[model samples]
Target: MISFSQVTKRYPGAGGGYEALKSATLDIQPGEMVFITGHSGAGKSTLLKLMAAIERPTSGTVLVNHQNVSTLRASALPFVRRNFGLMFQDHKLLYDRSVYQNVVLPLNIIGYNAAEAGKRVRAALDKVGLLAKEKAMPVTLSGGEQQRLAIARAIVHRPSILLADEPTANLDAAYALELGELLRSFNQVGVTVVIATHDEQLQSRLQPRCIALAQGRVTQ
Candidate 1:
């Protein structure tokens, strides 16, 4: 479902520029679960961002579901993005909104009606074991619950692909494992999963097709 053809990304600097990704190429098929691992500044996050269209590459091509995402128009970008769910290092939940509202935001943006949104939100929350916390404010929940809320929000729209970046950074070991299992379950049901993380325990435990990076290059 994803194919990167010699993709390269660079950031313009005051002098010339700095390359964040250097001719990296990879392919991930549908229904596959993959892990991306690297130390800080190793370009792991860049790869994820490129895949999610949060950043465009400086050179080469990125194709998703047969569309060359590198050439997608801004007007069509949202439609492309709607095909994948994304999770960030920080939970990025709204402290003021209820869990239900947080999950509802994505569906609302995509024009889902109240009835359908409510149903999907509940199902996603249930998948993350947070159905009971739907009415609770994000700040009132534990860290694990908040992250689960993020997961619920990401999948509430039923995107075909899921991308998570440092999802377990703030969680305890137990909760991290719980989150990994949760992601795996989603993958099992046919949502292609790609996780960018530095968590070694998760790497050793889940044993997905790991793609390691170092200094903007794939080392593994």
Candidate 2:
């Protein structure tokens, strides 16, 4: 579970600073599928970063599974982040690596043995319907396939929470819907899914608990 209390995130600049989130208070319970919907620069991505401890709140608090991430030491960030799987707006895939290699990277970082890493990589690819593409280069895949590959990479480590930013961006309607269903399936099995997107169609179809933002404020 995660909680944000009066959380504000500011980036310093010449003209005072820019606030990405203003007193944003919300809670995401364990195993819940939640959508953060807002226009560009509405702080959806910032909220996700705060939850994952990639960004600390400029003010207030962020609690992930009861740990105060806002004040956690730099050395402790990796440990906290291990519990999260992140999918960026960009695919962020290594174009030179095979799909299997891409998904296996996280496991490699954590020092998982080859046998275990291989098993997890295959299972994750299968879950995202990309098992057959394991040996394929990222550039060879279609847009939807690339997205699926990203999802596979994110979930390969079996993270407790999946934070996806604009997961359905740029795909066609059919592919977007398919991706939505794929993410929902993960939530069905109890992975906490948090998606930050402006794709209202996908949001409407899935009907997850939506937290809408406007001008960096949690309006709903």
Candidate 3:
């Protein structure tokens, strides 16, 4: 579970700092599928970053699974991040690597042995319907396939929470719906799913607990 209490994130610049989030507070419970809906620059991305401890809050607190991430040391951040599976608007795939290689990277980083890593990589690819493309280069896949590959890579480590930022931004309607169903499936099996998107249609179709943001504040 994630909780934010009066959290604010500011970036320093001339004419005072810019606040990306203004005392925003919200809670995402374990195994819940939640959507953060807002226009561009409404702090959806900042909220996700704060939840994952990628960026420290400028004020207030952020708690993940009862740990105060706002005060966690840099060395402890990685351990906290391990519990989260992150997907970005950009596919962020290694174009030069094969799909299998891309998904296996996370396991490799955590020192998973070759046999175990191979099994996980294949399983993740299969879950995203990309098992057959394991040997293909990322550039060879279609846009939808590329996004599926990214999802495979994110879930290969079996993270407790899945956080996606504008995941369907680049996909067509059909593909976007397919991806939404895929994420919902993960939530059904108990992975906490948090998606930040502007697509009202997607939210309407899925009907997850909605959290609306406006001008960096939680408006709903």
Order candidates by TM-score, high to low: 3, 2, 1
- Residues 1-220, candidate 3, lDDT per residue (tens digit)? 8999999999999888899999998999999999999999999999989988899999999999999998889999999998999998887899989999999998988889999999999999999999999999999999999999999999999999999999999999999999999999999999999999999889999999999999899999
| CA deviation > 4 Å runs, candidate 1 | none
State every prediction's TM-score relative to the real structure. Answer: 0.97, 0.97, 0.98
- Across 26-100, the per-residue lDDT of candidate 1 in tens digits comes to 999999999988998989889988898888889999998988888999888788888889898887788888899
lDDT of every predicted structure (CA atoms):
0.91, 0.93, 0.93
- Model 1, residue 51: C-alpha shift (Å): 0.6
Lowest-scoring 10 consecutive residues by lDDT in candidate 3? 88-97
| After superposition, candidate 2 runs with Cα above 4 Å error | none
- Please count the clashing residue pairs in each candidate, in the order shown: 0, 0, 0
Error of model 1, residue 109, in angstroms: 1.2
